[model samples]
Target: MKRVLTEAELKDLLQAQPEWKLQEGKLIREWTFSNFLGSMAFVNRVATIAEEAGHHPDIEIHYNHVVLALISHDAGGITRRDAAMAAKISTELASHTSPKHE
Candidate 1:
């Protein structure tokens, strides 16, 4: 099973993902898209990634805004898996120009 990330390690990992915020033992990010369709597109992409990695995140969509919070429930907090997923999502976002962070 995956282990929870140590405070130091979490701090370091978060440094590399400046857009992600650590909140309540979860790695969180808020994304703003051009519109509802654009937001749904981003959600679909995230779903594909989650399926590929076998790690899913809690997603909240509000019109043009999408919020993602990732945590390893089995590990009881954020883990390396969460960080890795966040990195993958970040890379995916980098490839798109429609989604601007809010």
Candidate 2:
């Protein structure tokens, strides 16, 4: 059965996701892009992942910044699933920021 994550567990998870933070009782991460198109591309990629995982995030995109919040309404709060998604997002952002080799 799915369960809500405890404070200690949340802290441990957050340690690995340095870009994400606990904001107003929610797990959130912010990203900045070079342009609106870049921000939208990131959002679309995140949307696809969320849909595949059957989990959705609260997203806000403005200019070149995108803020993402992850919470499980069905679980009544944060869960392992939320942490996992955050980790995945962190990885994706890292890759996105990396210089491409060609």
Q: What TM-scores do the predictions have?
A: 0.92, 0.88
Could you say which candidate leads in TM-score? 1
Residue 60 accuracy (lDDT) in model 2: 95
- Evaluated at residue 4, the lDDT of candidate 1 is 91
Q: Give each model's clash number.
A: 0, 0
- In model 2, the worst 10-residue window by lDDT is 93-102
lDDT of 2 by residue, 9-49 (tens): 98898787767788777888777788898889889989988
Report the lDDT of model 1 for residue 31.
82
Model 2 collision count: 0
- Which TM-score value belongs to model 2? 0.88
lDDT per model vs. reference: 0.87, 0.82
Q: Which segments of model 2 are wrong by more than 4 Å?
A: 97-102
